[model samples]
Target chain A: GESVGLHLPTLSVQEGDNSIINCAYSNSASDYFIWYKQESGKGPQFIIDIRSNMDKRQGQRVTVLLNKTVKHLSLQIAATQPGDSAVYFCAETFPGNQFYFGTGTSLTVIP
Target chain B: EAGVAQSPRYKIIEKRQSVAFWCNPISGHATLYWYQQILGQGPKLLIQFQNNGVVDDSQLPKDRFSAERLKGVDSTLKIQPAKLEDSAVYLCASSLFGRSYNEQFFGPGTRLTVL
Candidate 1:
């Protein structure tokens, strides 16, 4: 079955440094992708999203790069902070609004 | 605005037991979704409802899992004769409309432990 996957299960970065999380999806028909942040004991919170038509989208201090040709997605956080410590997941949406999520990547920001 | 709401933050039940979880989506949202997230894994969509009508339930375990979004507002997910693999966090999410580009707001989730 087609699925979404992450490149790394965990990552560690010094506070104030930048961080990048990578994800790969198998479904080429997917039209939309999103990045979510989940703190311990909480549900995922939307961070940013991009459509297949676009190659990049940016939010406050965060950027989502989509490589439709390779079916790859990446999230970049500038000047990572302690609050950025959480698990990040990438999701792809099919035509009917059904979303498929990847095995999350845990990001640890050290002070 | 309030985010998605769910009940009974945690539950522990033995295998073969029955359990139910509830969710209240953001007001006026017409699309509701139920997802199962196992520890160390991402959330997997189990079902989706569009204004009280099921739009997709392909991944739902129909033999033991069922859901309904009565009145297109609050929804419930029930699992009968639960199995150990059913132990996971059930998350409820909603979007303004059932569109692939719309953002989905998620709830805190209900954690279930099947003993």
Candidate 2:
């Protein structure tokens, strides 16, 4: 079965530094990829999303980069803030509309 | 528009007991989804509903779990004979149309603890 996975389980960064979180997906048929941030005791929140046709998408202070060749995805947060601390998940959607999520990466921003 | 709504923000039950959570999607939304999120993990789709019809429930523990969307308005997810592993947060979300059509809006979620 195809799966989406992350390279790291945890990421720590200073409040003013740039942070990078990596993910890898093995579903070639996936046409869309989305990033979600979940705070403790809350549901996941939509971050940024990228379509197969595009390589990158940028949002408020977050950027999602998708590399189909390596089946890899990355989320870069500019000027990491304390609010950025959360569990990040990457999800891929296939033509069937089913989405498979990665294990997730926990980001900790040091204030 | 109002966001998705869920009830019983928290619950604690023993194994073999029955528990249920309710969700009401955004007004006019046609797609509803139920997901389970364990501690430190991502939300896993348990079932999906398009209007009042079941779209997918392959991942749901059918023998112990059941879900239904009555009148395409509110939905309920019931877990009977709950197990220890059932302790987690149950999240409900809805999209404007369908999974292939729009992004999802999530609810606060119902946290369950099976003791």
Interface RMSDs of all predictions? 1.1, 1.6
True contacts kept of 2: 0.48
Docking quality (DockQ) for each candidate = 0.87, 0.62
Error of 1 at B14 (Å): 0.6
After best superposition, candidate 1 residue A100: deviation in angstroms?
A: 0.5
Clashing residue pairs in all predictions, respectively, total 0, 0
Which predicted model would earn the best DockQ? Answer: 1
Tens-place lDDT per residue, model 2, A9-108, is 9999999999999999987888899888988877788898899899988888889998999999999999999999999999888677667788899999
C-alpha RMSD values across all candidates: 0.8, 1.1
Q: Residue-wise lDDT of candidate 2 within B1-115, one digit each (tens)? A: 7899999999999999999999999999999999998887778999999999999998999999999999999999999999999999999999887755268888999999999
**Tens digits of per-residue lDDT for model 1 on A4-103?**
9999999999999999999999999999999999999999999999999999999999999999889999999999999999999999987865888999
lDDT of 2: 0.91
**lDDT scores of the candidates, listed in order:** 0.96, 0.91
